[model samples]
Target chain A: MINNQFLVFVKKEFAHVLRDRKTLLVLFGLPVMQILIFGFALTNEVKNASIVVLDQAKDHQSQRLIGRIGASRYFDIEGAVDDEEAIEQNLRSGKVKMALVIPSGFSYDLAHRNKAGLRIIADASDPNTANTLSNYLSSIIMDEQAELNANVPVPYTIIPEMRMLYNPQLKGVHNFVPGVMALVLMLVCVMMTAISIVREKETGTMEILLVSPFKPLLVILSKAVPYLLLSLVNVGTILLLSVFVLDLPVNGSILLLLAESTMFIITCLSIGLFISVKAQSQQTAMLISLMGMMLPTILFSGFMFPIENMPKPLQAITNIVPSRWYYIIVKSIMIKGLGFQAIWKETAILAGMAVFLTLVSLKNFKIRLE
Target chain B: METVIKTHELTKRYGDFIAANAISLEVYKGEIFGFLGANGAGKTTAMRMLCGLSTPSSGSAEIAGYDIYRQTEQVKKNIGYMSQKFSLYEDLTVMENIRFFGGIYGLGSKDIRLKGQALIKQLGLESEEKKLVGSLPLGWKQKLAFSVAILHSPKIVFLDEPTGGVDPLTRRQFWDLIYEAADRGITIFVTTHYMDEAEYCGRLSIMVDGNVKALDTPSALKEQYHATSMDDVFYELARGAKRSE
Candidate 1:
């Protein structure tokens, strides 16, 4: 008999889902957009370089050298500066990635000694780009000289050995498909759960659930079950796409990956339930979920940026983001192929968070009823 | 008499204010008792306490001989309540709403389906079984809500202004259903603002500012106040209560 009520409630839940086209579009459209945007827009690969030139020698020869440097497809001419001080300030302020310092007598010396010196001061704050810059700069110079030497004699050949490490091909899908999956799961699990609970409260339907013969704990469980099921499907869809379309391998055990994702999704769901209990209105629920969960997850969960590079206090705060631990588990299993032995610590942390949040909300529900 | 509901000075206090003033009420096995009061007159609060949905500050209520304090589950099982808001899962259909209440009341699956079918036919909602309750007209929704409220056939059914927004014709139809339920020996304790509805009650209590102003049959209240109808008695009692303040 209770199955009928369950069926009725589930039907109503799905009805609200279908009737609200905008929310439905957001629920499905958002995940697709996140996958595509993260896989393409917020990719791990580097594309265009902005080069600022600080040329003290403004002669026609120096001008010709600058023109050749800008002609290369690798670097775009960001701007030109007069003195080294301006270049230093721009680099320090992160306005430009690489600054070319052409010496005052660059053309005059190249004519006599067949050797011209230039300093490429790249911002090393971003280590990958900084390392790439020196190699790219020398190649650009060599390429220009090679072009000059095509018709005449150039003193020596500069055979630049340029190699990329870690991700040599710079495949866009390598980091991003997994990142998109993490982002979509994080949003769907947390925001959807929180908003659904708050929607019940705002619409005065939650009171009916509370007054029912079911225990408050059962009520919470029932509320969470359908969402958990939906997220599993979403996780499956994401996995299928990444494997089929992007051709990424399931390097880790698929079982371990699914199990870890289920745990993390529950953790996110619990956090959302906690937020719903704290908020009184749908707007408050949404704002708290966005500002409290989404922003921190994007910033500190290693989904968009590296946590290790952040300041100390921020690193400390990142520990509290549930997405941070979940991100670690997903990345380690999906990308690194690390097994449970290495990922268990993060799994335990997420488990603790899920239990803590669910228990606390349950306590609040009973206490309020009392 | 086997009391279906009994309250001893059942009261609820909302910080310095008495929501349900110290007053006692009793209901017999098959009586249809009406509770009348103005808006925010503590009728709904008192009903909520009796249904074990709200806790009284200093007094106690027993539903079907079960003390509300210690045996809430038993009280919940033996009593049914329909809130003034016509509370139901609006996104669900008529069949779905009936099925939900029946299931929560612990009916078996076969019985739930059987009773649901019978109810849809009885309420003239057979054709509207698949229609969402939110999309249905208000009168149809009200009738369906009351049907679901009694789907479990509890010992006592509490209705809090169930016919408030419904039209007069629908209200008459609803009262006919209540009479039939009372005839079948299901005690009905209902609250209403309409004076004409109060006239249909075997007995009633009038509340004003959290206190019972009068308790008797409608004719008795009218005769005592030297008035023509329940409306006059209500106004007279209210004015008297106001003067006492």
Candidate 2:
């Protein structure tokens, strides 16, 4: 009996969703746009940064150092500056992100004194770029010095060997793909489900449905089923884009990733149901879903901002946002190649939230019209 | 006549304000019971209680031999309801709305298909079955809503101002449909502010300030109040109402 009724109800819901073109676009287009934007355009890696050099020595070593810095893809040599004042002008005008100063007698000091002095200055206005450019330049100089000392043995030269595990190239796509998955799923499931349910109330169809013999829980469940399916489709789209377009592969089990995503979707649907029960109109539901759910999913999920950088009180609040847990789970399974044993706590928390929200919303769902 | 709906002093209250007072009434089988009132006269509140959409704060009521409080599912099964607002899904096609409503009422697929065809044919919407409900005129939508309400052969259909915003010719046609359902032995409990529509009911109840001020046939009400028309009778009862919308 339930099978027939549920099928018919779900079919009606699908018709509602498909007939509206605007909702369809948001459901499918948002994740694709977000993935492409984050993958290629909004990246943390700095490349081809412009820099000015003050080469006072004009010797073989100083010329070689400037050649090495320009040769690297990290910096673009924007002509040489003869004086410290010129370097200061380039830095202040933002014409150069960094400036290099090579002292005189550089090759003689390096060969006889076994030491050379080179000062690197960077514009600290954009701190991240400044820090990254300075580090890149220092690394290039270190490599040149190591090559110079290839034949002569040094007493105590300690070089730290660094290995970037999981993401060897330190690609931004690897980080944002999981974050986007969490964000897109949360927005689509929560906002769409809430609006759909509250829309019935606004249109007066909910009154008719409530008056029918159909159980109220069945009605609410049927509303959520379509969005759940759509959210899963969204997840599939995001994952495919990440793999094919972004070139970010799932390092762990695909089945596990899908399973965890389904859990998160269910949690979001329950939240949507809760909002629908509390909200009286579509506008209220949309506002609550976007402001109440989307903002926290973006801010507290540790995607755009680091949770640790926030105040201690806010860090404690981040624990309650379900996306925070889902973000960690996705990163663990997708990036770290971990299994269920690794993400069991997060999965358990999500499951607990799903069950708890479903119960609360169901309990609060009024069978009788007020 | 067999009693289909019986209420003993049914009352609903919200804190100190009473939305529906101790109003006792009964609706016999196959009778057109007109619930008449002003805007805030509590006509809707009483109908909501009888339809099992709202629980009464005091008194008792029964719908089709089922206790309203305990057997609400059974009560819902035997009744169909249309609210003051347009109740059909605007995005859904005519045939789709019929099938969905029929499906939720536990009708088999074959039954739904047959009933949907008959309903569409009877409403003269054969060419417009594929069009969305919102695209139809207000009169057509109202007629379709009425037809769908009784699709499952429910014992009673409750209409809360089903024809509020429509042309007079359309309202006459709507009343014709109501009369036909009444002839098929389906009890229609309708609420309306139109005095002309009130005169067409077999019996009418006028409410004022949450209390049933008068209950009888329209002719008897007119005679008892010595009024010329149902409008004069309604004004005589409702002019004393303390609440105004």
Clashing pairs in 2: none
What TM value does model 1 have?
0.76
What value of lDDT does candidate 2 attain over all alpha carbons?
Answer: 0.88
lDDT of 1 by residue, B116-160 (tens): 998899888878999889999888888887788788888888888
Give the alpha carbon lDDT tens digit for every residue of A147-247 in model 1. 65677565633333333323343332235656666677777777877888888777655655555564566556666777777778878877876677544
Q: What's each prediction's clash count?
A: 0, 0
Clashing pairs in 1: none
The CA lDDT of each predicted structure is: 0.77, 0.88
Stretches of candidate 1 exceeding 4 Å from the true structure:
A1-22, A42-174, B240-245
TM-score of each: 0.76, 0.82
Expressed between 0 and 1, the share of native interface contacts present in candidate 2 is: 0.87
Q: How accurate is candidate 1 locally (lDDT)?
A: 0.77
